[model samples]
Target: MNEYSLLVLATQYSFTAAFAAMAAGTLYFMMERNNLTPEYSPVASLCAMVSLVAAINYFVMKDTVGLDGQAASLAGFATDYRYIDWLITTPLLLAVLPVLLGRSRMNNGMMARLLAVDVLMIVVGYIGEVSINRAGGGTMTGWWCLLISMACWFYILYVLFAEIGRALEGADSYLKSSLGFLRTYLVISWVVYPLGYLIAVLDLSDNLLIGREMVYCIADVIAKVGFGMAAVSVAKRLSAMQWEARS
Candidate 1:
């Protein structure tokens, strides 16, 4: 196979791996959710939903980069697929924060605002990506689109780091430490998406255009599945505590 075909196969297999992980995560979250207290149940459901949505999305994604390692399918829907997945799954993933932090402890309005910004970030980023797609390369419009989206992304970082990370009043040390790692995980995993876009915007390398999809596949698994696993574990602990207190 040629280089393009190899890249396509790599991307395709990466998506398959993501699909398998998410599918497994869904089952795991669903099973373990029953072990949590009712108050902590929402996080489990949200985690499962995030995995379920991405799992289905990745299953379809397996088709977009083309079958048999050809660019036969990446035409109309390819650009929109991931954004749609993000539109649905991102909010759900973020919503888990408020649940984990406890609604009483978190600023509901601020959290709501953060989720709104997250949605806008994805929407505008999608617009920018579509512009790039239509141009078959970078464009001035795409640059501005990405810049605005990055602005939104910075706001999200503020919310995550400043708003949510600022307080942990009733949280145990274990949970506090988990959130710390999760915050860092968000920092590490979430940044890859925009950087992938930057690779395209900068026109860094032709190979990266194909390779970015592989990067995204890896990031999605880490962001969604890895995050879900941690969230569920935390919820399980909290539930056990709640159950013990009741006893």
Candidate 2:
């Protein structure tokens, strides 16, 4: 097959794998939600909903990139779908972090601030990517948006590591451990996004575009499925602890 065809196939398979991973995790969490602690039911449900969004996003994303392995025309809904997915799923994923942190610890104001940062990060990211690919607005505009998004990202990491990390010191040991896993997960797995943006958005070459999509697909599976599975484990542990206390 030609290089373009190969790239298309790779993208198709990669996103398909992501969809499967997310969808499977969704089902698993939903099925087991009843057995979890009452507090954890919402966590399980949110995991399922987030994965469902990923699964749907993958199917829609297939059309965003043409068979030539480049981003398709922006005129169609397909090109805009990525932003839509982020609009929905990004907040959900961020919400999971604070929920796990516990409302009493995080407080409403802190949650709102964190979520505002998350929204800005995603929105700026979307603007950067769409401007690069669709706006005909030149690379500088997109780069500027990307730079702003990066600043927001650094702020988020600071909160997680410096602020929340400090707060976790007096928390339940199990919660501290689980939140640690989440912090590590965000740093290690979510970092792929900016890297992918640099790869595809900077150059916009066909090959580089394909590479970007593949990178994103891989990151999606690892972040969503991996994060959800890890959360499930934490929920299970929390449920056991709660059960022990009651018994």
Q: What is the C-alpha RMSD, rounded to one decimal, of candidate 2?
A: 2.9
RMSD of each: 2.1, 2.9
- The list of candidate 2 runs beyond 4 A from truth reads 1-4, 63-77, 135-138
Worst 10 residues of 1 by lDDT: 68-77
What lDDT does model 1 reach? Answer: 0.82
User: Which pairs clash in model 2?
Assistant: none
Using all chains and alpha carbons, the TM-scores for the candidates as numbered come to 0.92, 0.88
lDDT, residue 206, candidate 2: 64
Prediction 1 TM-score vs. true: 0.92
